[model samples]
Target: MCGIIGIYGNPEAARMAALGMFAEQHRGQESCGLAVSDGKVIHLYKSMGLVKEVFTDEVLKTLPGYIAVGHVRYPTKGAATKFNTQPHLVETLFGPSYALASNGDLVNYDQIRARLEAENVYFNSDNDGELLVKYLAWQIIAKNKDVVEAIRCLMKDIKGAYSCVFCTRKELYMFRDPLSIRPMIWGKNINGDVVVASESCVLDILDVNGRSEVPAAGIIEVNADGVKVIGNNPAQYRQQNHHSYCVFEHIYFSRPDSYHFGENVFEVREDIGRKLAEQDKGLEADCVVPVPDSANFMAVGYSAASGIPLSLGLIRNHYIGRTFIKPEQTIRDESVRQKFNVLPNFFKGKKVVLVDDSIVRGTTIRKIVRMIKLAGAEEIHLRIGSPAICYSCYYGIDTPHREELAANRYSLEEIKERIGVNSLKYLDMNSLRECLKEPDEYCYACFDGKYPLEKE
Candidate 1:
């Protein structure tokens, strides 16, 4: 998944959007961008770094706008690079350029890209979001219609989930995929500036009034006049609590400090550890140690409930940027190892209750377990916060193939043997539901293989 934000009616809308992007940076750290409208034209700036690193003072000065949209990207399909970092801008044949910042994937991108390319449409990037804009822009140009109508028509052709925002010189348009696989929220700052973002924690940082989340698979547009729904078909945007919101958003990507899908991530993750402890009665794990940054919060909860002390067993190399994004197996493996260094001092003479967010292919998790064993950890009891991922995420998560999924192929005992862990315990699905105060509201499709939205 990615992080996106938009603001209208602010003198420094680009700056404001950048700030919001920063707050949601945990949702995506690959690339960051900001594009803003100054009433005359759209100015754009983006790069391959975190918000603070990419939006230095000089970069911010170049973007002038009172209407702005920004994005922090975690590539699901495209390469994460300066070449792909969005707020992708397109100059329309009829009007000034517009910028789009998207936060989810489109399953039909391949088909659509082929259609446009067959018709000789020049594609600037292979990014799914950029392709979407190209299709919309081409339609707008061909039909001589407003971008909104073009987007509405464009929706008929796309077949994947998305919660996206686009900004023109005078307007901000926002929409979610009919399935609403991703979460997008909107609010207003104290200054009456309209804002939209992926999570409410960003709104808290901006002192914005946390309005209710926009409806799933719905459309809303904001300008100087404020927010309003413009378009959506009842069949596609059917309102229901299907609850297919991406589980990874809570288990991993989103900050533990945020709230989404009607549950506080921090609280749910804590409950995950508590529940895991309750289920795994006789584990011989010595100390609770996190797998690094994302697991730190849940590990704390595990430690408190398990009567074990928490320690940093893995030290992350924070400076390791996307230097190894090649779509190859060996490179990805080497990248994960390079990004983390086992802390022998932390694991010395200790049996570890290793807390991690989620286990996908179990590649990194397995490697981490091996690292702990190499570090002289006497025994390893691996605990996970979320239910086992047994299915592929058609939404936005980068889950491995189902055949390769650890939980799908191997039982907990089998997985423990494969990883050489003393014991392994994953949270029970029902127990995970109980962890959430609003159990029925959020989607657990990844765990249960229940898709919330139908494909067109």
Candidate 2:
């Protein structure tokens, strides 16, 4: 998954995009990029680093423009290199023209790339965002299709999750996949300049008070003609009757302050915690401790419901990025060691209920459990917010191989033994659905192995 940002009609568009991308740094950490249009040409700057590291004040000043599109990438489709970094720019004889940045992965990447190559379309990166921009450029340049028409055709043919921000030298466009598997929200700041991002928290930081989701298969364009919102009939593109919004976003990826899919992200997490507490009616624990950051609110609900006092026993290192989002196993393992620590004098002889969002490979949590055990906790009763992630994700997550998943490799009892936890309980599938407003509208493919879309 990645975070995308776009700005229109703002002179300091690049600076605004930088601030917005900073807010979404949690979504991606491997690379960050920006494409700014001064209404004459598009200026591009990207590097393999965090948003703050790459887009310094001096760097933002160099990219002065009224329209900007930015991306924070967590590699899923390609290697974590500067070549795969996005805000992929395409130039023509006229000058540098179109630039696009996107969040989400394409299921038919290989098939579509092969088709484009057959038409003599050259590629520079294996990134899905590059494939998307190239496909649109092909339609617009070769077939003479308008941007809207090309995006419509894209929805019809490209199968997967994509929330994109595309821009010409003079205009900005935003669009989402037919299933709306990812979050994309847009609004205007107090200056009436339009802004779009992967999360509502970005809008909040930009002082955009009134925001709305870019509809499923919907397109939004901003130019001198003014803002236009275009909706698409999902039935025309996807076979699924209801939108298969990614349920995992609420469970883990997005920030607690963000809202999407008609539900507050933190609220959903809290409900998951409450349900988890309900499941453990007679269980006793001295205190409820969250894994910090993502599970902070979940632990709050669990503590309130279970009548166990909440303790900030585990302190996370804000400097360290999320371990789960780290691209490689070695990097993830190293991050787990540096990311968290038990508070001094805490967890000593105490029975702790450890609340975590979900376990993917189980490596991070296992190491965390060992830390608490070493810290002298009498017992660690692990409570997971979501159901077991048995199936690998094909949409945008890095869990592309089933062999890497904990649930796929081990049973619940085996998992408990491996993690060295006193007891283990994952929130059941039915309980998880009860946490969402429109349960049927969300995708639970990772938990249930019922995929909404498949790799072609």
Candidate 3:
């Protein structure tokens, strides 16, 4: 997964984009990039590091423009190399320049890239965002189509979850797939500058006005004329089945303060915790302790419902990025070690209910459980806020293969034994659906393996 933002009609577009990227730093951390269009030229700057590290004052000053696009890379479809870093820019022979940044993975990227290569479209990197920009450039420059027409054609040809923002010297564009598997929202600032980003949190941070979601299967364009929705054929773009917005965004990915799919992310997680308490009604514990950060709200609900006092048993290092966003397993493991520390005083001689978002590989949680045990917790009850992630996600989340997921490999009892926890429970699907505003509209592919896209 990645974070993408576009700024239009603002003289300090690069600065605003930098702020937006900073607000979304949690979404990605391997690398960050920015591309700014000064009406005469598009200046690009990117490096492997955090957003703050990559966009120092000196770097931002160099990227002067009234239109800008930014990206934070997490390396889902390509290696964590400089070549794969984004805000991918494409220049045509006729002098038109376009830069693109995206937030989701493409299922048919290989097929599309092969076809483009056969037609003599050279490629610089394996990054899906690069392929996407190239495809758009091909349609607009080679096929002689307008931006809207090219995107409409693209919607018909491309298959996967892509919530993207594209910018040119004169205009900005944003779009999401029919399923809306990833989030993208747009709004205008008080200064009449239009902005689009992967989450509403960016809009809030940037103080954008009239913020609203970019319509699913829809294209939004912002130019000198202001914001306009452009699509000649709406019926063709309409989703045939139930919309499959990724439910995991609520469970873990999104910021608590952000709203997506008509629900507050923190509220949904709190509700999940409440339902978890309802399901495991008779369980007894001295206190409810969240794994920290993402699961904090969930544990609050669990504490409120179960009538157990909440305690900060695990203290997170705010300096460390999320372990899950790290590219390699070894790095993730090292990050986990540095990410949290157990509060021995809180756990000593206490029976605690340990609340966490979800367990993917079971490695991190197992280590956490051991730490709590070492702190003198008599009984450690693991309560997960989401269902077991048994399948890999093709829609941008970095879930491991089915066989690598702990749930897919072991039974509940076996898992409990492996994690060295006294007991374990995950939120049931019924409870999960009950907590959401529109359960039918959400995707549970990782938990249930019901992909919205047709399987190859």
Candidate 4:
């Protein structure tokens, strides 16, 4: 997935947009970009790297304006390269150039690209962002529709999740898909300039929380005039039926410190851990050991619920970046070890409940279980924070197919054997629903296999 932000009316909008993106870097670590408009023309900069690494002073300083939009992206629809990075700018019939950044996958991208290509249009990159821009430009150019109407029409052609922010020289706008599979929130800044972003952390980081947050899966447009909502007709999309938010965001993608869809990810994870503890009631675990990073919050919940001390038995190397490619199998195995180091003293002779976010292809967890054994942990029991991932996500996440999933391929007992754990306890799907006060409000498609959007 990705993160998008926009600001209008503030003179230092470009800087504000940068701040928003900096807060949103965790959502996507592959590339970052920004576009600013001074109520005239648009200026742009994008690079394939982290937000801090890509948008340095030289890049950020180059963008000057009272209005700006930015994006931090990870490649789901295209390859990781500067060519595919976003804040894609193109002038529309409306006036100055408009830049767009998206936060989710569109399953219909292949169909849309093929349909457009047949009409004598050539493309520069195999990027979904490019295809979206081409479609919007074509709609405004070919159909003579206004930007909003063009967007409305174009969205009808898109399939899957999207929580996006768009900006022209004049206005800042935000939107999410009918299902709102992704998270996008907006608040007002101290200057009364609107702040629209994918995470509330942007508002927290920028001190822009006066305005609570925008409604999900709808349009939020802010200009010098004011902010307004549009295309909020739930009936329109519901008439066709496409709705399911991604539950994985709360489990892994989003930072526990952030807020989205009115649910605190940290709290939800804690609830997941408590529920996991409930399922494995009275388990004899000496301490809870989190699989550094993703499972930290859940570990705390398990520790509190089970009355076991939480220990940092495993430490993560912060320098292991989001993008790392290994040319050999041996190197790949070594890379996992480098990312995590077991504290021999902390884990030695302990009955450890290893808290991990989720198990996918099975190899990593299997290897990690072996590693902990070598670390002298007396007994290794596994507790997963999220329900066993039995499906692959066609969305932004890098998940393997259902058949390839460890859970899908093996029974509970078999999985425990494969992972070499004393026992494996997974949070049940029903337990997941109970954790969320409102089940319909949340999407458990991955667990229940309820495909909201039509498949490609």
Each model's TM-score, in the order given? 0.88, 0.99, 0.98, 0.92
Q: What is candidate 1's local distance difference test score?
A: 0.77
lDDT of 1 by residue, 1-456 (tens): 788998888998878888898888767778888888898878888887788988888888888878888998877767766777887898756566778888877766778888888877877777877887777778877667787777776666776677788877888888877656678888787788888899888888888875767776567878767678764553653446354566676677777778777778787777777787787667666678887677787887787787877777688887554322224457668878888888657777887788887887777777878877888888887888888889876666666368867889988888888878877778888887787775666667778886665432
lDDT of 3 by residue, 179-244 (tens): 788888898888888999989999998888698888877899888887898644434654555678
Please, what are the lDDT tens digits per residue for candidate 4 over residues 252-290? 778788887668989998988888888877788788988
Q: Write the per-residue lDDT of candidate 2 for residues 1-456, one digit (tens) a residue.
A: 899999999999999999999999999999999999999989999999999899998998899899999999999999998999998999898743899999999999999999999999999999999999999999999999999999998998899999999999999999999999999999998889999999999999999988999999999999999999998898899887899999999999999999999999999999999999999999989999999899999999999899999999999999999899898999999998899999988999999999999999999999999999999999999999999999989889999999999999999999999999999999999999999999999999999889899878
The C-alpha stretches of model 4 lying farther than 4 A from their native spots are: 91-96, 239-243, 322-335
Report lDDT (CA) for all predictions: 0.77, 0.95, 0.89, 0.76
Question: Cα miss at 150, model 4 (Å)?
Answer: 1.1
**What are the runs in model 1 whose C-alpha is more than 4 Å off?**
81-83, 117-120, 144-147, 229-241, 312-317, 320-346, 408-411, 438-443, 453-456
Query: Which numbered prediction scores highest in lDDT against the true structure?
Result: 2
Model 3 gets an lDDT of 0.89
Order by lDDT, highest first: 2, 3, 1, 4
Best by TM-score: 2
> What's model 4's TM-score?
0.92
Superposed on all Cα atoms, model 1 deviates from the true structure by an RMSD in Å of: 3.1
Output the better candidate (3/4) by TM-score. 3
